[model samples]
Target: MEKKCINCSQRFNCRDSYISWLFFIIGLIAAIAIRSVTFLMELGDIYAKIAWYLGVGGFFIFFVYKFRINHRRSRFIKANKLMEKVSGRLELKERDYEWIGSLLCSLSAKKERINYFVIFGLSALALVIAIYMDFVR
Candidate 1:
């Protein structure tokens, strides 16, 4: 909500976060297309094998990094919203606001506990996808 905190001088923007999300989607799409093409190509050929490793492996790394960046950016944006609300109630100085924002952001960033059933469900879906894509072709 607040672009900049007057007390802490910390700034937050959604533009970077949105950009990271966009890149993540685009990267995922490109990776899937590359994998599909590779699957269709002759596995005996060396070039196709190289493409398989590079395309899929590079995409996996890129996806993880971008996901982390987006996660942190989301936390930063949440912290800004918190600073906006709490600043009105406290007569704190710059350092105090900074400390409060950091503390709140850290607390907010922790993920809720995930059920093992959900994990199992997603894994099952992934297995189905792999079976269909590889064998049903």
Candidate 2:
């Protein structure tokens, strides 16, 4: 179980999201190391190559699938941090945190969700541009 960001309208990490990410990283490292070892040894094992590709691909897919949930958590964390400075002035109690956050969510649902989508879309676009520049240049 992982602790969710208090500001999130949706409660997350009912499961082990962070641990899943850790496993994803670990799996990626292990897969790379194994592939490197096998390729360097000139094993020429087709099955080993296939296994490595599938493992890495699966980890990547899982990461993409979980990215949205993680993004929400990040949004919540950022909002909460900003609020922390103003928390005292706002007279917000520990419990009032979620109530106020939820109120904002209801009042500006489109704006908040759109903001997140815009940020994500820009980042993905940047990644694509970077990959193209690196590979096509």
Predicted structure with the largest TM-score when compared to the true one: 2
Residue-pair clashes per prediction, in order, are 0, 0
Q: Rate the local accuracy (lDDT) of all candidates.
A: 0.53, 0.53
What is candidate 1's CA lDDT for residue 61? 66
Q: What's the C-alpha lDDT at position 103 in model 1?
A: 54
**Model 1: per-residue lDDT, tens digit, 1-137?**
55643322243421235654555555554455444443446444666566566657756866677578669766865756655657567466676566566555534431211223433554466567668767886
C-alpha positional error of residue 73 in candidate 1 after TM-score superposition, expressed in Å: 1.4
Q: How far is candidate 2 from the true structure (C-alpha RMSD, Å)?
A: 12.5
Q: How big is the positional error of residue 15 in model 2, measured in Å on the Cα after superposition?
A: 6.9
* Per-model TM-score versus the true fold: 0.34, 0.35
Residue pairs with colliding backbones in model 2 are none
